[model samples]
Target: MEDGLLSLKWNNHKITFFEILRVLREKANYTDATIAVEGKFYPVHKLVMSTCSEYFSEIFERTPCKSPVIVLKDVRSQDMDALLDYMYLGEVNVNQNDLASLLKTAECLRIKGLAVPDEDPTKFRKGQSDDRRESPPPKRRRHEDSSSQPLSQRPVSPTISASSKTTPPSRTPPLQHQTSSLPVSQSQDSVHDSIVDPPPMVKVEMEEADDPDDGYSRRDNSYDGGSVNEGDGDFGTELSKSEHDPDNYGSGSFPGPSIQPGGDLPWDEGDSSSFPPEGFSGDLPAGQQPQGAEGLELGWLGGNEAFRCHLCTVSCGSSTQLQRHVMTHTGEKPFSCHYCSHRTARKYNLKIHLRDVHGVPIDRRFARY
Candidate 1:
């Protein structure tokens, strides 16, 4: 128990350390060194890298350069990215396609715990074949076996045969037998008797009997069809229709609230109250402007702050702009020019390229600014 507890504690500490490293790498928090590979820079912590990799530690010790930028050669950017990811997360996704390159990179860096065992692929395939040969074939189902045989050859239970012989074969009774017991009324209303006596009386009694709330003699008021109150100017019909139709929940019609051109939304018109007064500059005299306005826009309490891009040194006024700028570094060009093979990172850039280079009119679909 003591040994198990110590093992558990050590495992927990290792997991916690990996989690801290992953967070630091993801957020680029307190990153002192940058690894430049294939024109892409990956920010990493020097202490973690030095402690984890002896090659990195030796390079840092031997080099006299003050800058923390280290350039890698021959190694693919994706493999280096995967290496860094494994170093931080303690686990990485490796497949047959990338396995060779990953192993080479790991061996070069002297990264521990990534050595592949010397096992032959043909031996594994032979073992699988031997196992398959030793396994027994699946047994056929009893029903299927019986179905494959002739009827005379198939076995039948004595009890089933006896029951089938005793039971009468099902057949539709003649109409004459059903009406023979009833006396035929020889009167002027004979047509009505023939039409109503056969099935209508039984159907009416069954429908009336199904209503448990009321007795069989009482009529169903809930049914709008064939009811005397149905002529009450379509109110019941409208109510029933509305209850059954899912689209007409509260009212029979669904109309969204009318939104006028520019005044319906608060954001449509810019809020002038949040901005400084007209012709008011920060460099002007303090007495010329409002008293509290100077420090209001300068301090952290003000909402005039901007989100800065961590990949590059560019700062943006909004998160959307910063995200668009980060995509340039990520090399994700989702928008492509329609006329030519030109592609751009932003939709607006694609539109501008199409208008200027391709001499094509910018359609409304690609006119996002």
Candidate 2:
């Protein structure tokens, strides 16, 4: 068998080269070309610009000059700067106000990978009906009979005609038994006496049933007839003991087999002992410091010590400040606006953009860490 060595690869050298070129452009070192926009000159490398942009390459080939200074018109200086940044770094900082102009500029210049998708006009218009018509109308409840109409919409029943109607028969009989039993004068005298004098009051005590199944027999506050059954067993004893004991009121405990914390209680997976006491310092063990301590300690700004970025020479007093500063280089935006396509590296910046640009109300839901 022939023995051969295998090699595993990780890093991309192309990206590293582009990052170095970006650093060189940012530092304005070794620049061979100049882009003049709005009375401002940005130093840039001609080879990098020509290779990245077709417009630049064509312009340079057609018009060769002693001094490689190209003047731009009708383009904001900031947009030009962002375009150059994207050409070198492969990323651009896009916002709501400048996105349209920058996209237009990129399209005009025939820049690759910077075009925005066209939005449908109907999506932003009001009172526009959907063309798909996919949703069916809501089902309505109706009477089972085909001829029956809803009560509200049904025609009123025809009134009885006086000519064809027959009178209903009298419901009352002669009442012979009542007349024979009670004389007319005696009944009248009795009714007159009752009206003159009110009836006497009678006391009637309500008796509760002895049955255990009867709900009224069991009272939460007091027992019926001041007695409890012996057959109730331990339940009655526990109830009485808990009712009379002040400490047991509202306490979720029973007389026998009570649960004890730290013994039978559910075990927490977190290491509670590792946490420092209330007054103790938050210092960790040797070589065991927290991974994102810089970002987490942004609120403690009294000390105000500086922390430097690993990729750049920018130094920030807090981790949060450093993280926000690093986004300018990496172009990583995690926070986004709900109403628009605006995004920012820090949440507060997104909130400010929403409030100032879009007239959105400041709410706690938009709070940035």
Worst 10 residues of 2 by lDDT: 249-258
lDDT of 2 by residue, 88-166 (tens): 7655433333444454445333243432112211111112232212211111111112132222211110001111111
Give the TM-score of each candidate: 0.29, 0.29
Which regions of candidate 2 fall more than 4 Å away from where they truly are?
1-10, 115-369
User: What is candidate 1's lDDT per residue for 205-252, written digit by digit as tens?
Assistant: 001111121111111111001001001122112122221111101110
RMSD to the true structure for each prediction, in A, is 40.0, 45.4
lDDT over C-alpha atoms for residue 281 of model 1? 18
**Whole-structure CA lDDT of model 2:** 0.32
Cα error, residue 345 of model 1, in Å, equals 24
